[model samples]
Each structure stands twice: as structure tokens, then as C-alpha cells.
Target chain A: MSNTSAPNKDLPGTILAFIFIGVGCLAWWDTFDMGDSDSYVFPRAVIVTLIVCCLLLIGRNIIWGGGKNHKPLDGSAWRRIGLVLAMLGTALLMPVFGFIIVGMVLFGVLIIIAMFEPWTRKLAIAYPLIGATIVISFYLLFAVLLNVTLPTGSLFD
Target chain B: MENPISYFFMSWSDPYLLLMTAAGTFAGVYVGAIPGLSVTMAVSILISFTFSWDTNEALALMVGVYMGGVYGGSRTAILLNIPCAPSAIATAIDGYPLAKRGEAGTAIGVATVMSFIGGLVGILVLAVAAPLVSEFALMFAPRDYLLLAVIGILLVGSLSGESLAKGVFAGALGVIIGMVGLDPLTAEGRFTFDSITMMGGIHYVTAMIGFFGVAEALAQLHHLETPAIKQKLERITPKWSVVKRYIPLSIRTSFIGVFIGALPGTGGDIAALMAYDHAKRSVKDPSRKFGEGAMEGLVAPESANNAAVGGAYIPMLTLGIPGDAVTAVFIGALYIHGLNPGPMLMIETPHLFWFTVGALMLANVFMLIFGLTGVRLFIKLVECPRAILVPLILILSVVGTYAIQNNVVDVYWMLGFGIFGYFLKIYGYQVGPVILGVILGPLMDVSYRRAIISTRESFGDFMLEMVTNPISALLSAALVFLVVSQTPMYKRWTNKRRSV
Candidate 1:
């Protein structure tokens, strides 16, 4: 019944969050080279604390395997990966194509990635129309009403 | 008290200010209900548009939005797990669970009523004890704020700590993210990697959207086919018994919100989290466990964060110090209006102070009306199919992140954090503490250094000073008490005492 939670998995995604920490650790090592001692003091202290905590978490995972129902990443991993890729592509291209164009395209890409039901004729027509309406509405709301200047791409200019 | 009574009802008496307050409260609900829009962003934007408007009219509108927005954040937190603002982080812990149990209507109802009570209590305190509270807020040493941040982080240390390591690591990593830009004190970069884009620093709003908004969409991929739970909407207003049960707790957390809000740098987010911690500690017979659909969990934070609205104004009116980002914007608003905010403000123009108090009280009444009525429409959002809702949320998150600064780099950071946060979630860790860490990390960093320098940089002297000073000693004792209470030994001892 728990949403967003893979209700049956016990192997809490330690490997993933840990991978992120590993990346953070690399950047933190550069704190040693800063010219001013005042700048690095708090960060260095936090780095030490983080490293210690990471070790403890890793140790706990090894000694006590999580939920008995622990399973490896399954086929849903593909959808998760695709969701990330579609959004990443949209983000990278937004400045080139602009928010109006990229936003409409991203909505279509996401619907296809997330959809499980077989597409019907009505479904085909409605999805794109609704997506465009939502995108345009938000654009007007942010750009006109809120006074935030949304990106206009080189393509549009 | 010296101000004329009519000044207290100025917004109520004026047709223009009354309409502005009502319109502001209405727009605030939708703004706060949306996934990536923030009250700070809203207020900041309003400043640009209101530059030519009457200052009193502008303040009236903003006061309504501030009160309504803080309460509105709970809408998404309850309906979906995403907290639009940091203030509602605690609300989602139990609120989302309540929605899963098909009680979204009841949860929103509880939050709205409790928020009303909390907002009223906050305004009441602002009226009765603004000066006394402002003076107390000033009395806190830098070390005391540092201690408060530490305790805030440690609250995560106690949450489902089946392994305390993950919780602490997540929070510490968030602190590292908060430190990415130039050092506030020394002007040297902490982790910018010599890149110009990195020097601007990452906004916590982006981090907030990533961790709560996009990450939640990623997690929903596994449940696209799961039918939405139809929420029971019969009882929008809580029963008299339910209201009576929570009144005492509501008042306690409202005071907590006011106290934390009165502090110069802290605001509702910290206040709500602290109040949530207090609820967990005090309520021995909760209807359900704290994170598992307990009504108490929803009530405590809702009240505290809303109460913080009144608390945030105290320093601004009394000492000319802005309490947080939104109030800092208010300070700007005050100046544009040609009214100076300081100790002289009360003596010179008591009418303005009383006018604000009245406008805030009016806003609280508006918040209650709007908050309860909007539940009927907002609950439908949670019921939208995952396949459609997921895509909508993802796009909204992207657009909202872009709107923050019109920068693609911030959008990139938002997506990166979203992917990381997705993994953190499926891994069974709560991202609330990480957001808390991001919000409080710099404050802690600045305060610790100031406290240390105040002791002439002698580690021994710093340690000595904590005990020698009354406030520091009290905070130190509280910190120690929290740590001791978290130990398994303490749990076992308490269990035996209860059984006996």
C-alpha cells in the first residue's frame, strides 16, 4: 500500500546513495588546497563526520542484511533510467530549443515512458492536447503573471 | 497598547486593503499548493510589481499570502508526500500515510483547523508580547543558535534510526551541498571547483523540488498501474472532540513556532521540525505511530509553522532585523513604504505596528476559510492516475526550477539531485533531515565560528563559556538530555518504568 516504496524490497538502495557520497567525497578532498584556513574549517569538519557516518552505514548493511524480502533492481529499473534520461535530455536542450518547445516535448516523452496501458485512438489524441494546454498555461502563469522571464532559445531568436 | 484601537482594525475597516488581503490569501493557496512554487519566491515577485502601489496596501496583501502560504504547503504534503516548502516537511511524514489510507480529506481538515488555531495564537502573541519576545530572541548567544541547529539535525538521528549512520550521513551530505558557494565569512570558495556557475551557489528551493518533487515521481514509476485511493470527503471540518484533544498540543507548538520564528535567522521550517520532535516525545498515546498516519503528527507542525508567521514579524517591527528571507523582503517593503523599522518604529508610528497586528489577524481568518474550502478540489489531485500525474509533476518540477532564476544550470542541478534523492528514498531513508541540514548548515557554520571567536579561539575557553553562561548552559543541558534519551539504554529504562 506504500506508494513510491517498492513495497517488497529490503535492500535499501545503499549502493546508489553511497555512490553519490563517493562523488561528494572526491570534491571534498580539494578543500585541503584552499588558501584560507577560515574557509575550509567547517567543511573539513563536516567531511570527517560524513566519512565516519558512511563507514558506519556500510558496516551496518554488511552485518545485518536488510528486509528478508530483499531483491535486486528489476525490470522497472529501465523505466526509472528512461525517466532520468528524458528529463536530462530536456534540461540540456531547453536553452537551445527554449522552455515552450522543450516543455511540450518533455511531457510527451514522460507520458510514453510512464504509460502501461495500450494506446487507444482517443488516448493518442487527448494526451498531446492536454499536455500542450498544461504547458502553455504554466508558461503564461510564470512569464506573464509572476514576471519570471522564461528561457527563449537561440532557435526561437 | 498606546496605539488607537482603530489602527488594529485598519485592514478590516478599509475596503481596498480588505480586498487585497482576500485576493492575496486566495492566490497564496494555489501558489503554495503547486509543487515547486515557494512563498519566498511569491513575496519577492510581488515586491517588483508593488513598487508603485501604496505600501500599506502591499503589506496587507503580503501578510495574507505569508499566513496563507505557510498553511497551504500542507496541502501537497498531505495529498502527496512532496512538501512545497520546508515548513511542511514534517506534515508529509504522517500526512502522506493518511492519504494512502484514503483519509486525505480528514488529514487536510485537521491541518487547516490546527493551522488556524496556530495562526491566531501567533498573531495574539505578536500583539501581546512583541517586545518581550524580541528581547528574548536577542538574548540568544551565537553558540545557542549553533546548539539549536545541532539539535535540529539530531532529531533526524532519532527517526527510524534502525541504523543511525544513514540518517547522519544524508544530513551531513546536505551540509556539504549547502557549502558549495563562496564562504560567507571568508569569501573563499568551499567546493566550487573553480567554476563560475558553481560560485552563485545552489538554491535550496531547487534542492527541495529535486528531493521532494522529481524524486517522488521516479518512485511512482513502480506503481503506475496501482489504482488511486478514493478519499472520503464527508467530514471536512474536524469534530469537536478531535479539536478538544489537540488544543493543548496546538498551543504548545504555536509557542514553539513563535519562539523559533522570533529568532533572526530561523523561521517556520525549523519551528515545525522542532515541534514535530516535541510531538514525538510528548504524546504517549498517539492514535497511530508518529510517521504512520497519526493525526498528532499532522497537527503539531501545521500549528507551529503557521504560528511562525506572527513570530517572524516580531524582530522586524521591534529591532529592524528581518527574521528570515520573506521577512527580509518585508524589511525592503517597509523601506519602500517610507517607514523605518527599528526601536523608534513603535514610539514614532505605533499605528503601523497596530495596523500589521490587525491585518495579520484578518489573514488568519481568511486562511481558515480558504484552507478548509480548498480541500474538496485539492483531494482530486491526489486521485489523478499515476501515469498522468507522474509526467505532470516531472514537467512542473523542471519548469518551476527554471522559473527560479531563468538558468539552465539550476535546472541541471535539480535533475541531478532528483536522481540522487530517488535512490535515497527507495533505500528507505527520509530526505527531510537533508533539507533541514541544507537550510540550517550555513547558519550553524556562521554561528559556530562567531561563538568560537567570541571565546578568543581557545577550544578550552569555548567549552568553558558554554557552561559559564546561563543560556549556553541550559542549551548544553538540553542537547545532552536529547542524546541521552536516544540511547537504547534510555528506551529500555523508560519501557521498564512504564511496565512497572
Candidate 2:
């Protein structure tokens, strides 16, 4: 219950609280401008409740150092960030380069970053084969079997 | 009308239906094993393709996937401590530990058999009690439905690891996400901020895939180099003695699943959590400590969650209401096929009802057969080096989100939420309540608004009616009790009394 420890552990909680509070405020502001009271009622109620919950979270962390010493964000977490960026990049590139080509590129990049191992002879051969197999299988399953119209990539066309 | 007996055996008689069912179950295992790909995502995608197919064939395959998916989630939970679905959360408590002790095969085999029994229990209840339960379901009003959502939200207590405040914040955030887009009734934007994409609202399935699948993959990165726990392959199936020992426990937990799954806005996730808590409290002494690989711990939740599958279908088939998220998608499939699913559905298309029940029985058998045989192979999957699995999971998440509506924006939302969910998980803030909130938020909003609107939008009148209506009054009382019992004051008072 003491707040004597270093505050590094509660950093995430504090940040989350601030984000929630900000989102709640922005939502409340939008609700006020929506014109129709009927349309805004549910959101208004929910935002008010959300703001209160955010405040409580902030108060708990400040008063009792709650969520302290929890898995503090470390440099290693950047690996995860890299993975997310790669996927996001894939999404952006898929329409331009097609899902298959972009997917394989991102898959290979992500594997290297995630595994922390340089490409070996075995991986060099296996990675492309596996990546190609996965990409094409997804294409066939969605595009051919399910008949979904997947993005063909403007470049490919 | 055709004889009900023939309708029940329709899948057995039709080779195509049988094939679809088996294939669906097989696909479901791998899908459920994968962190990001969900049964809901699979079924939602299937709906697009199956729209042109016969209703029976679509339902047959979907039932297979649904049954297999629920059971499949425990696979990752046991082996990797990453639950593929929210319903498998409790399974990881004991399951992962068992795996650490090289008992992954036995743990999964036990989970599979228990899941089969639970599925059978749920189906039997659905067949025998659908009409009776549906009749009872008809008695619920909008206010009662709102109360049900409230009760469902309160179950976030079970999901919150160590902090109720954090859970509340997470859950409230989910509700806020669910509140985006146009108001359901008025069609006016509430939090869209004038963007076209924002007006469409965030899909809970998208939120779920982000939270459970993508977030989980990121979390796994923290332990990327942690060597895989090698599993013991001997005695994959439990002895008949072990099976007999857990039968009573499975039965009790399955009942819990059926009842919760039958309720609107609740499903296997809630049922499984409740059953796990019950197992912890009821078992005098488990095979191991509850969170330390207890067989009772594994059995209780595995059976209950699968049983809840049957429970979920009851309301979908008998009443018009969806029992859970997947059932909500099932209802959409029904409407797409030009069939109404409600009280009248039983009277008009009884064949559909029997067909669903029969398909469920067949799927359960397939789940058992497939579940038992794949132990050695699945362990290899679990042992697959993290370097390869993590990236593949990320790709699957993106693909699954894209397949949802073929929209790039949803893919963005999925990644954004995935990052957010990762931070929340690391900070000990549960992402489960947030997803639960997204799912139940709309239900709560619509029910609350409709209830008040029916009373002329008078808050006092709504309060008066809540107490006057017998069904609403009962639900209101239960909600009050649930909230009070979860409070610190109540815990202190009970503890003090117990000490004397």
C-alpha cells in the first residue's frame, strides 16, 4: 500500500489512465456537438462512466502504487514494436504489391527480427519455401476455394 | 413435414454434409490452435461463401467449426500458456503447468474427452430443453436483458488478474469502442468525429482477434528464446478409471456452461470461468493445486466451455436471440439464408432445429476422435521454434482481419488495438474485459434505450417498472447481489464473520 518505490513500474498505468481520460473527454466533446440528444444519450452516459473509471485508475496508482513492479516496459519490447510495424507496412503495401509478395517479404523480415538469429543455410532454403507455401495457401483458401476477391496488387496487374 | 428422425440423421445420410463437417472440425483445430485466427473469424468468412449453399450444409459445417474451435483453444493454452480464445483462459492455469511437467499429452487428452462429454451434455440439454427454455426466454423484457448484460460485465472480476480498477477501465474502454459509429436506433454518429470509417464502428470480433491473437503473439516475444516444454507422448488418452473419476465433475460444470451459454450476452467464456472458480472451491483436494496443474482444474473448464456451445445454440435456435458472439453470427447466417430464427423458427422449420442438434452430436464425436489422435503432432507444433511461429501468427492475424470485410481500415484497427492490447497486458491490465465490453456494449445500450423508450423516456417510470415487473425485479435483484458480493466491504464483513 506504500508508494515509496520508484514510479517506473506504474508508468504504463499512468499513461493508460491519461489516454483513457483524453479519449473520454474527446468523445464527450463530440457527443455535445451531435445535435440530437437521442443519438448522444448512450454515449454521454458511457463516457461519463469511462471518465470516472479512468480517474479511479489514476487515483489507485498514485495513492497505493497499484500495478507497480509489474512487467515494466523494457528495450526488448521494441522487438514486438518492430513486428507490429512490419505487419502495418504489409497492410499498406499489399494493395500495391499484392498480398502474396508483400506477405512473403514481411514474413521473412519479421522472422529475422523475432528469432534474433542471422540467416543460416537451412533457414535460407526453408524460409522461402515455407513463406511461399503459406502465402499461396492463404490465397487459394480465400481467393479460390471461398471465392473471395483478394487484392491482386496494382503492380502485378 | 418430414419425420424428425430423418431430419436428425440428415448429415449422416448426406455425404457432402458429412464431409464438410469433418473438414470443418479439422480446420477448426488448427485455426483454434493459431493465436490470431478465431472461430468467429472463420465462420464470418464462411458466411460469405456459404450464402449460396444449402442452409443445411452451411449449418453443418459451422456447427462442426464451432464445436471444434471451442475445444481447440485449450491446445495452445496447455502447451504455451497462451490461450487462443478468451474461454480457454482458466485452462492455462493448470494446463501450462501440466505441460511443464511433461504431461501436455495427458492434459490435452483429458481436456478433449471432457470437452466431448461437455458437448454431449450441452446438446442433450438443447434438444430436450430448447422449447422449455425458449418459453422461459420469452418472458424476459428489455430491462431484463440489460440486467443480464450488467451481470455479464461484472464477471470481469474473474478475468482481472489483480486489479478491479484496471479491469473496470479496460472494460469501460471496450464499451467506448463499442459505442463508436452511428447510434443503432437514431442512425446518428456518436463518436465518429466526421470520418467515414469511424461511422462504421469497431467490430468486437476485430477487437477480440487483436486482444487474444495479436496481443498474445507480442507477449510471446518476451519469452521468444524460452525453450519449448517437451511433452510426454505416452498414455495420451486417460484410462477409463480417470474418465470415470471426472464424470460427476464434468456433469456439474457442463450444467453451469449450459445455463450461462443459454443466457443472452453471455457465452462459453463466462461459463468456463465460473466453472473453474467452482472447481477450485468444490474439489476437496485436486490432483495438484488449482493453479498448479490440477486435473479437476482442467476438466471443469474444458467441459463447461464445450457444454456452453450447446447452450449458445439454444437461444439462437429456439428463441430469436443469439446466446453469444458466434451465435450472433449464426443468426446473421440464418437471415442471409432467408430463414428467421426465433420462437416461430421451431414451429416452422423444426427440421433445421433437429439438423443442428444432429450435427453437434456428430461434431462432438469428430472432436473426440481428432482430439485424441493428434497429440504427438500438435506437441511438435507447440514445440515449433518461436522464431517461425510468431511471424506466421502475425500474418494470420492480418489475413483474418482483412478477410472480415475486405477492408484495409479494419486491418489498421486490428494492429492499433493489438499494440494497445499488448501494453495493457504487460501492465497487468486484462484485455479480456475490454473485448467483453465491446461485445456486450451494444446489447446493453440498445436494451437500456428500448426499455426506457417504452416507458416514455421517464427515468422514474423505468425504475418503477423494473420493480413492478416480476422478471425485471428478479434480474435487478440478482444484479444488485452480484455487485454487492464483489465489493471489498462485503468481503471484509464476510471474512470478519467467518473468523468468529
Candidate 3:
């Protein structure tokens, strides 16, 4: 390792500050179109405060160093990527494959990526059974008891 | 007035409500013990299912979950070294080490009994203080309320994050999001962006689910492979000697819990941490060295966090401000049930006040019953792999968000927020402030506008009124103090004083 003392946190911090600055500028400009003063007053006040806070963040990062020193995360990066994709994919596919179908697919993808154990005959039988039970129980609770209409997919329609 | 005694025993007398309370507490134990599951998330989701319930039934169940969940977190903190909630983070310091020494059962039992004691203290405080506070709150002007909302957001922001700026940033972002849709005063669009869909604005429940439920699940994805630790069990109950020995310490910390918990926007997690700090400084001797399995470690945090549940209700019931995130969700549930929670809540629905106290007392009792028993079953459930739990949480978040308004658009908004929230968390920003901002943002806007209108929109008069009014002046000073304390000059001054 070159040196643990210095990590390039300023790059991310500065970039985040600029991002908020951009949001602040855009919001300020958007306020021009509001016909009434009262409609934009609170938002304009909030926008200004936000911009100042971002500037302060930049100053603090320069003087005192990065705030909370949390490492991005450990373990497999592939798992995080898969987990995000599985969830986002579930949302995208929910309207197409239906809630149950997409949910099970998400569960299948998650199980494969999340598993750290050596695949065994017992786990093969157990994992599927357990996942099915969890999904079905939630379905009954939400659909039957709570009366939420789970999407049956556009294909069925 | 009409004999509050009958209402006091409402949950205990009614069979269905009694069952709901018991069942809620039982479920709450598992929810709190399970890593990644939170009382906030559970209460938010449960609102969807309980929407059609009688107001009493819903209140009973939510209180049961709230009381039980606060105590349940100590379980995994003792066994697995993984605190399921922020409130139990302190518990794990002493709890897991004790478990390593084959004293897991004792630590858990002590935590349970202390938690029960702390909970009773919180309830007693709430019963006495809320009525008085509500009466006091009736005198608040719009300017005072505006200042209050500002202070509440700043307080939450100041304490939650590593840096005050980042905390303020998140809160401001939430306020912006909340400012979307119809301007209630002018009945004109604020941040609608010309989309008809934006007219209704984003629901705070959607924000709650996205930030807490889905984001937490995604965050836990990074630790899915972490193995579970086995716990050793012995005498499931502690001796009277041990319990009696910790009573003074428990009571002292329980008071700390109530005081911190009653503060708007702070809650049990902060209370537990402060109590643990006090125990470390106050106790000269221990059953073992602190963080090396000291009994005092478990007792202090467990007592304080439970007491905080009662403390948290004070502001929510009296002033319509959330003392913490769980109470924030409770406020949302109250609104959905057509009940407005504020200073007038006590006067308008006195029965509701007595019933809530009764229900909380019932929940506290149920928490003890469920906390002491079912160790084996709980351990097995806790052993469930993270691979399954994370996915289930996501699904639940989806169903819950969609159920709120039966809108697919809300689900999309929820998922968008979840993804955005994940990045915010990784970068070390606290989402608690953001949620607090959303909860208080609308109230802040209305109060500010009303105050401004009172002054005929004269900015100077508004500023002058802030200083002239006693309540407003006091609140403004507190806000100034909170902000000033975060400045480098103040930090340097404090350091210099301590060095002398």
C-alpha cells in the first residue's frame, strides 16, 4: 500500500458540492416561471440555504478532511450490482411479468448471487421451499387480507 | 371528565384489541431482532394493512409494535454482534462479549427486565407531561410554530450525520421534494413541472418506505454472506440480586432516555448511546470490564431505549412533532386514520388520550411476556440467511408503497428514492434528517406563510416578531445555539476550556 494516511476524498466531495450547486442554480431559475411570490418564497429560501450548505461542505472537506469515514462496503462487488439489478429489474418487469413472476425471478437471481455456501443437495431442496413460502405468505397478506391488487402483467391482459 | 378510568382499561377489556396487541408485540419481537428490519419500516407497512381497522385497533397494534420493537433489538445485539437497529448499537458492545463468555442468556434476561422497567418510566412521564405540554402548546403562534419546525429539522440534522452541513443538505433536499405539487395557499403549482401527475405531490409514506425499507435492504446486500454466530444458553432468568443491583442505574438512565426522547427529532438510539456513555463514566467497577461483557452495559442501554419509546410519544401527542422516526411514522398512521395529532388532540379526543396510555401499558406488559420466553424459536428465526431476508424486504416495500394510493407511479417514485438514498448512505449522509424534513416541511411552509401574512409580508416585521415574542425568541436562540455549536470557533473554544 502506498500510504493509508491520504485518500482522495476531495474529488468525490467537490463533485457532490458542484452537483448541489447545479441543483440550486436550476431551482433558482425555475422560480422565475412561478406566477405568484408566495409559491416560490419557501422553495427559494430553501434553495439558497442548500447552496450555502454545499459551499460549507466544500470548505469543511478542505480544512477538516472527509466527514464520516465509511468504506464503500466490503464483500463481493458483483453481489451489490446483482442486488441492485435484481430490485430494479423487478420493478421494470413487474408490469410485464406480473408481480409474482417478477418477484420469484428476483428471488432466484438474488439467491444465486447472495449465496456464499457450497451448493449442496440439501440447500437445493431447502432454498427453493423457503423462498416460495416467504413469497406466498406475503402475497396472501397483501392481496387477500389487505386487498391490494397485485399486477397480473400486461401480457395476461 | 367523563371518568377516564373506563378508557384506561380499553385494550385490556376488549378481546379483539387484546389479541391485536399481543400479536403485534409478538411480531414486533421478530421484526426488531431481525437485522435490516426496523420498527419504522414495520409500522409504515402495517399502516397499509391496518387502514380499514377501527381507530382503536390500529392504535393498539402500532403501540404494541413500537414498545416490543424497541426491546427486541437487544436480542441480536447480544447474540450475533449485529445490532438490528440503531438503538441497540450500544447493547452489542457489552452484549456480544458476554455471549462469548457463555453468559448470553443472562445478558438477554437483564436487558428484558431493565427494558420493562424503563418502558414503565417512559409511560409515566408521558401520562403526566403530555397533558401539561398540550396545554402550554395552545399558546403557540404561527411564528412560534415556524421557528419550532426549523429547530426540529435542525436538531435532527445536527445530531444524525457526521457533519452538520451534510445533514442540513439532506433535510433541505427533503423539504424541496415536499414542496412539490399544489401550493395550498395560492392553489397554484409549486414544483409541478407542468406534469398533471405532480399535482398531488409525493406522499411522505412513499418517502418513508423508499428511504427506510428498500434502501436498508440494498445496503444489507453488501453483508449478505456474513455468517451467523451461535449463542450459548443457560439460566434464562437473572437472579433477584442482579436485578436489584441495577435498579438505581436503570432508573437513572431511564430518566435520561425520557428527557432525550421527548426532544423533538431525537429518539431511543441517541438515548441508549448517552446512557451507555454515562454508565462507562459513572460505574467504577463492573461484573467485567466495560465492552468485555459488563452487566452494566446491557442494563443501561436496554433500560434507556425502552424508556425512550414513552419519551418519544410526548412531542408527537402534545405538539404534533415527532421525537424520532418511529413516532414520525406513527403520526402518518394517525393522519391516515382521520385523526389530527396536535395540541388539540388531547382536548378534542380525551378518550383517545386515555386509550393510548392504556394500549401502551398493555404493549409494555406484552413485551415482557414475549421478551422472556421463546428463546429457541427466536434464535432459529434469527439464523435465517440474509439472502432471503433482503429480497422479502424489497417485495414488502413494493407492496406497501403501491397499497398507499393504489398508484404505480408511487412505486416508481419509491424505487427512484431507494436508489438515490443508497448512494446518499454510502457517502455518509444520514437519511433520518431527510425524512424529518419531509415530515416537517409542509408544516414549516404553512407556518412561515401564515406568520408572513400576519406581518403583511414585511420581512423586517417578521424578523422583529421572532425576537419580540417570548416563545419565538427562546426557540430562535436555541436554533442559533445549535448552529453556533457546530462552528469551528465554538469547537476550538470548547477544546480550550477543557484543556484548562
- Measured over all alpha carbons after superposition, the RMSD of each candidate to the real structure, in angstroms, is 2.8, 3.9, 6.2
The CAPRI-style docking tier of model 1 reads: medium
True lDDT of residue B333, candidate 2: 96
Cα displacement (Å) at residue B202, model 2: 1.4
Q: What ordering of candidates by DockQ runs from best to worst?
A: 1, 3, 2
Best by TM-score: 1
TM-score of chain A of 3: 0.85
DockQ preference between candidates 1 and 3, better one: 1
Q: What is the TM-score of chain B in candidate 2?
A: 0.84
Top candidate on lDDT is: 1
In model 3, the runs with Cα more than 4 Å from the true position are A2-9, A62-76, B1-119, B122-131, B221-226, B229-360, B371-382
* Local accuracy of candidate 2 as per-residue lDDT tens digits, B347-449: 9999999999999999999999999986898787566667777776677777777776777788889888888888787777777678768877888889989
lDDT string, candidate 3, B282-313, tens digits: 88788888768999988998999999998888
- Between prediction 1 and prediction 2, the one with superior DockQ is 1
lDDT of model 2 at residue B156?
61
- Worst window of 10 by summed lDDT in candidate 1 chain B: B157-166
Alpha carbon lDDT of residue B158, candidate 1?
62
Looking at model 2, the pairs that clash are none
